[model samples]
Structure formats: structure tokens, C-alpha cells
Target: MDHTNKLFVIKLTHTLIWMFFVAVIFYVVYSGITGAINTYTWLGIVLVIGEGIVLLLFRMFCPLTVLARKYSDSQKDNFDIFLPNWLAKNNKLIFTTIFLIGLVLVIIRTLF
Candidate 1:
């Protein structure tokens, strides 16, 4: 396949995998907050916090997007992924807010 096609494949894989990750993260948090205190509770918190560290390390841009930029030149908000334009543009904000809320819920449930 050509370079562009290869890049598209990589980006598509990344986007699909990321969607799964988002779902699992949310599930973990929800479970943790709802009294399912188990490994998932800690795992979920650690993973989300780790994501925050990675985001900071990448200067708030997803590392995959930065990598995709090296391969493709499309500037459309969703060019690198299948997300909506607004979502692709402000994913960090949206997910970060959700993550924070989930994290709070986890903490609160763990504490009391």
C-alpha cells in the first residue's frame, strides 16, 4: 500500500483502540464509584492519572495525533480520526472534565 494508506491505517487503528480505552476507563470509574471496590477501582484511577501525565508530557496533544501529523497533511479536525469535528478539536477538554469527575467520584466512594 501507499504511504497515505499506511498512515490512514495507523491512524484508524489508533482511533479505534482509543475509543475502547475511553469506554473501559469510564466503566472502571463508574464501577469504582458504585461500590465495586476491587482491582478495577485502583487500576482505573491509576490509568486515568497516568493518562493525565502523558497528556502533560505531550503538551496536551495526543501522542498519536502528533505521530499521525508526521505521516499525513490533512488539516480537517477529524482527518486523523473518525470523531466529530468538535470532539476531535476539544477532546482533551471533554475527556479531562469527565476524567476529573470520575476521579472525584472514585475518591469520594473510596473515602466514605
Candidate 2:
């Protein structure tokens, strides 16, 4: 496929994934707030805020942003870490980082 098609497909995929994520998060937050789930405290509220910020950041500066930059500048790279076909690639690392950071934040919040 041409670069335009590749970018288009990637972007469309990203948009769909992002929409699903937002919907899930909203549903969970709504459930939490409405007592559909177990009781929640201020920590739940803070987690919701964190989720929103992370989602916004992903939407605004996604892996595809690098593709746009490369396309605009006509630059070529050896390979892309976030390429579409690297299934299950680097996922553990990314998730581990997220988990660690979230765990640390929760611990600090609990302590403080």
C-alpha cells in the first residue's frame, strides 16, 4: 500500500481504539459514581481524572503522530516501534511501566 493508505488505515484504527477506550472508561466511571460498583472514594475520582488525561494525551500525541511527522518531512526510518504488524510487541514493557507508575502514585496517595 502507498504511504497515504498506510497512514489512513493506522489513523482509522487508532480512532476506533480510542473511541472504545473512552466509552469503556466513561461506563466504568459512571457505574462507580452511581454505586453500581463497590463504594468509591476520592481516589476513584482521581483515577478518573488520570484516565481522562492519559486518554487525551494518547489521542493528541499517539504513535501515529510520528508517522505524520515522518510523512510531512519525507523522512524514512529503519523501522517503527509502533508499527501495526508488531503484534504483542513491547506491550509488556509499556504495560509494566504504566502499572509501576500507577502503583507508585497509589501508594503515595494512600500515604499522604
Candidate 3:
């Protein structure tokens, strides 16, 4: 495909992946808050942790973002994804805080 098409595909894929992770994160939080920990909760936790490792391996950049960089010169934060610019800019901070809170709740629920 052409560069434009390729970039669009990347952006779409990235947005879908972001949505999946958002669901997983919220599920984890919900499970923790409701004290309904189960196999799915553990699976979601593992997936989120794996995502964190991948980000670390990529030096805190999503691999898709790096790949998308080759296609566009736009400096906007949401250039690689369908998120709002402000949300894209602070995506990591926002999600990581939410994830941490959920994790803490999970730990507390599990231990208590």
C-alpha cells in the first residue's frame, strides 16, 4: 500500500489496540473494586504487564508509534492514533496512573 494507506492502517490498528487495553485496564479495576478476582482478572493483569514490558523495550514508545513515524511528519501527539491530541499527549501518564491504582486495589483485595 501507499504511505497514506499504510499510515491509516497503522493508526486504525493502534486505536483498536488502545481500546482493547483500555477495556482490559478497566476490567482489572472493576474486578478489584468489586472483589471479583478471577481467571480473567489475572489474564488482564498479565496482558497489561506485558504491554508495559513492551513499552519499556521500545524505550517507552509504542512500537506502532515508531513504525507510524516513518509514514508521517506530523508532530501532533495523536498523529499515530485516533485519540484526541490532549489524550494522546498524556496517554501514558493517564493510563499508568489508572493501572497503578487498580493494581494496588487488586493487591489489597488479594491480601485482605
Candidate 4:
């Protein structure tokens, strides 16, 4: 496969993975809001936090974003994931805030 094909594959894979991640994060947040705290909830929180560490370690960029840099020269935000440019640029902030809020909700639910 050539670079074009490789880039296409990478983009498709990144989109799929990102979509799945968004879905899982949404589910976790919804569960937290609905008083569904359980192993799955904590598992999702742990996974999100773990990935946040990866982003932090990589300078707030997902590992896939770092990998995508090798394939494309475009400086746009969506160069990595299928999200909008702004969202891609601020992905870390948005996701980390969401995850932290969810964690807090879970803790509150547990305490109350």
C-alpha cells in the first residue's frame, strides 16, 4: 500500500476508534448521572483517566494523534480524529473535564 492508502486506513481507523471512545464516554457519563455506579462505571473512569495520562504524557495529544502526525502534514485539528478542528484541538480539555465531572458525580452518588 502507498502513502495515500496508508493515510486513508489510518484516518478510518482513528475515526472508528474515536467514535467508539466517544460512545463509551457518553455511556459512562450517562450512567453516572443516572445513579448507575458500579464496576463498569469505575472501569470506564479508570480507562478514561488512564488514557488522560497518556494524553498528558504526550503533551495533551492522543497517541493516535501523535501517530497521525507521521502521515499528514496538514496542521488542522481534525487531521487526527474525525472531530471538528476546534474539538480536536481542545479534545483533552473537554474530555478530561467530562471525565472528572463524571467521577465527582459518582462519588457524590456513592456518598449520598
Candidate 5:
């Protein structure tokens, strides 16, 4: 009900969402590596792309992060989410690379 509670809720939600996407990304990678492409693979791809669009709309920041910013003035990278500072700092770069690799593998498997 207060700002602290609100920020905690936001951070928790953001962390859960991040975990979901991480699972999706790993599923995509697994699908590609195993040549098990299916409807779920496509769904994961679509979800990741949609997430990318959302990030772009927010100028590369998660909407939750933007919202969380209003509640806290911490300069730490992980302030908006329940991630380690280093992980939060490199989250985009790390996950994007993994997603792209999986995408490329998916394309190759699909074409061949």
C-alpha cells in the first residue's frame, strides 16, 4: 500500500517475469539443439520478440524497471529486480546473444 511495498511488488513481479523469459530462452535453445522444433518453439520465439519490442518501446529498459524507478532512487543495476547487480547489468546482452544463437540454429534446422 505504501511506496516500499509497491516497489517490493514491482521487483518481485519483474524477477518472476525474468525467470519466465529465461526458461523460454532455454527451451528455444534446447528445441534448436535437439532438432525438436514444434509449436512451442514458435511460441517462445514470438514471446521473445514481443519482449524485445517492449524493451525497444521503453528505450531498452523493461517497463517494470521504469515503473520501479518511480519508487526508488537506488543507482544499483539490480534495484528494479531481484537479480544480482552483475547479472542485472549484463542481462540483456547475455540473453540476447543466447536468443540469437538459438534463432540461428532454428533457422538452419528449419531450412535443412
Candidate 6:
């Protein structure tokens, strides 16, 4: 591949990594807003905002995206394969954990 293609691959990989993080953030907000807004209460609104902040913090401190970027950069020649697998396997795990946490929060909110 040419130099331009290599740089494109790198940039594309970075964009994908950022996108995963964005999706996670969106999921958190979606879960929070959907759950809490349905109740139509002040506490629920507060919780929604709280969850959004938590999600932002989680994204900020997350190591998985950093690792993914590193993995992507290392495989510019074969990045198409590497980036997807990294995002699919590792990113899925991380997002699943967040979803589970969201589930737990939903349950808690429902119960009390």
C-alpha cells in the first residue's frame, strides 16, 4: 500500500475506536433516559444526569480504547481484520459490562 493508504488506515482505525466509545456513551444515556423518564419524577431526572456523567467518566478512564488504538496502529497493513476483531471482542466485552451495570441499575430503580 502507498503512504496515503497507510495513513488512511490509521485514521480510519482511530475513528472506529472513537466510535465505539461514542456508542457506549450513547447506550448509557439511552438506558438512563428511557428508564428514568418513564417514571416522570425529579429523582429520575437526577439519576439520568448522574448516569450520563458516570458514562462520560467511564469513557474517559477506559483503557480498552487505548489498547485498541495501539492494536490498530500496529496492523496498518492488515487493519481491516485487526480493528474489527479488536472492537468486536474486546469492545463488546466492555460494552456488555456497561450494559449489565445498566441492567442492574434498572432493576434497582424498578424495585425501589
Q: Give the TM-score of candidate 4.
A: 0.87
Compute the lDDT of residue 39 as modeled in candidate 4. Answer: 88
What lDDT does candidate 1 reach at residue 79?
A: 72
Task: Using TM-score, rank the candidates from best to worst.
Answer: 5, 3, 4, 1, 2, 6
The stretch of ten residues in a row with the least summed lDDT in candidate 5 is 26-35
The lDDT of each candidate is 0.77, 0.49, 0.96, 0.78, 0.97, 0.52
Estimate, for each residue in 1-112, the C-alpha lDDT of model 4 and write its tens digit: 8766777777888889777667668767787799987788878877777877887899977677777788889989898666788887887678768767777888888899
The candidate that wins on TM-score is 5
What residue runs in model 2 are displaced by over 4 Å at the alpha carbon? 38-60, 73-112
Task: Estimate TM-scores for all models.
Answer: 0.85, 0.42, 0.98, 0.87, 0.98, 0.33
- For model 1, the stretches where C-alpha displacement exceeds 4 angstroms are none
Candidate 5 clashes between residue pairs 3 or more apart in a chain or in different chains = none
Q: Write the per-residue lDDT of candidate 5 for residues 1-112, one digit (tens) a residue.
A: 9999999999999999999999999999998899999999999999999999999999999999999999999999999999999999999999999999999999999999
User: How far in Å is the alpha carbon of 92 misplaced in model 2?
Assistant: 24
- Rank order (by lDDT, best first): 5, 3, 4, 1, 6, 2
Model 3: per-residue lDDT, tens digit, 1-112? 9999999999999999999999999998998899999999999999999999999999999999999999999999999999999999999999999988898899899999
Better of 5 and 6 by TM-score: 5
Best model number under lDDT: 5
Q: What is the lDDT of residue 97 in candidate 1?
A: 80
lDDT of 5: 0.97
TM-score of 1: 0.85
Candidate 5 lDDT score at position 111: 96
